[model samples]
Target: MLRLSKKTDYALMAMKHLALHGDRGASSAREIAEQYDIPAELMAKVLQRLVRRGLLLSHQGTRGGYQLARPATLMSVADVIQAVDGPLTVTACSTDDHACDQYTKCSVRDPLWRIKDRILTALAACTLAEIVDDTSVPTIPVTLSRRTPAPVTER
Candidate 1:
């Protein structure tokens, strides 16, 4: 199934929180965790990973915590997910050959690879700034209608 891991979800949440706050300087992981009802320790781990990935800047002293390493406009959802999850791969064969035994004779591999590429491309095209900017965010193109189709008139 196509899905983001929990760590990636938390990382995005954390980044969004920072983006919304802007240059309020650093914020404690505890504060972010509490605000979002996320586990503080898990958030710390996710934040540390982000720091290592250079997406986040962390400070250790008193009045210290974490902040965005760059403006939200410069970051993409793919970057955040990659920072936490290492890479966005929908299939084992695409990410690591050892993870799947059917890497060689899989007839469906090519189509699955294309689907993964499309998903990654869409994710890469979306920036944190685009998400933070309410008016610019794209809406999901889905519609639910309850009306029955009108009966055809006899000619």
Candidate 2:
């Protein structure tokens, strides 16, 4: 049942968009929203969260829009998710000091927290640069044949 919030999803999408089209300068939330058919209001809010987190920089002008605060390679998915959503957790006790009544007796709590930490680390390893690079290796890449070239192609 673990899943990312809608706002986090939007934030990641916005970051990727900015990284890809950053050469064109900033991109208004409205433009990105329209491109992806996301609600303009929601997109604006998600982008604002990123700006507040210092993952993005907002501009104010006739052509005002948003841009990445740093290179995409420097921005981690975990950072963007944490900005939109407080933090990633697999259980209620992952971040809360006060746990459920069973907290003390729960045998699985510790293991679950470990899982959450690993997940977080994995997310941090992925950067906006990787997401926007659509040229990633194909799902099924062509491989070299093992057969020799027919005994040096005798005439």
Best by lDDT: 1
Cα lDDT tens digits for candidate 2, 1-155 = 88999888888888989998999999999999999999999999999888999999999998889999999989888899899888787887754575588877889988898988988987888778988985751243459899757666567
Model 1 misses residue 69 by how many Å?
0.6
For all predicted structures, in order, the TM-scores are: 0.83, 0.84
Worst 10 residues of 2 by lDDT: 133-142
- Candidate-wise lDDT, in order: 0.88, 0.87
* Model 1 agreement with the true structure over 51-139: per-residue lDDT tens digits: 99999999888889999999898899999999998777766676446456676668888898888888888888889988788689776
RMSD to true structure for each model, in Å: 6.6, 11.1
- What's each prediction's clash count? 0, 0
Clashing pairs in 1: none
lDDT of 2: 0.87
